[model samples]
Target: MTKLFCILDGHSTPFSVVVSPDDTVDDLKKAIKKEKEPEFDYIPADKLNLWHVSIVIGDDEDEKTITLSEHPDAKKLHATSEISEVFGSAPAKKTIHVIVQRPSQGSSAGTSSQVNSK
Candidate 1:
């Protein structure tokens, strides 16, 4: 297991979350909820916009949008371009920065009803 340092919404400071390379985005969300649910007592964990959240690494210009089941090795590759910057390259555990993002205009817009009755 690697301890990933992350910054989440409603958090005042960075925190470490231990996870395995096999874990998925949903797994990470659950870990985040475990730490944040208490502070955001009124909001249900399911309503936290987990689907719209993004896990980022490094700077925005080089940032990548990771999939729900992307492994740590794959995410690390997406985060950095150097061949030496692979996961577990050093003594420190890998970390990922988290950010809340709005879904693309066309992503979920099709879910709405468009009545054509004239």
Candidate 2:
């Protein structure tokens, strides 16, 4: 098994998951959905907008944005490329901050701040 790190929504924070080298990009998507939203039955990978997410592998200095369909096969290669892109160029490791908004009670307000940090 190999570990892959991804930046969800371009936040400084990143999410990590372990995947079999044989697993496809599809598998990674499933794992991500399970980790981030276990309650949801399914999460369409394409809906994520491949360009919006960045991947980092190891010590590489190029960030590659790939579609979930392009992941699988040679998982390690993808992991390496992605990690290098996101973390390789920074002087210090960065953190990603996720912000969520909820509806406010009363006052006919419909806004709230509900963040989920991973």
Per lDDT, the best of the predicted structures is: 1
In order, candidate lDDTs are: 0.42, 0.40
In every candidate, how many clashes are there?
0, 18
Q: Candidate 1 lDDT (Cα, whole model)? A: 0.42
Residues 71-104 of candidate 1 have per-residue lDDT tens digits of 3332321221221223343324333444322234
Model 2 stretches with alpha carbons more than 4 Å out: 38-42, 50-118
Give the lDDT of residue 91 in candidate 1: 22
lDDT tens digits, residues 24-71, model 2?
A: 555555566566664223334322222222333444433543344443
Candidate 2 — what's its lDDT? Answer: 0.40
User: Candidate 1, 9: how far from true, in Å?
Assistant: 4.0
What lDDT score goes with residue 55 in model 1? Answer: 44
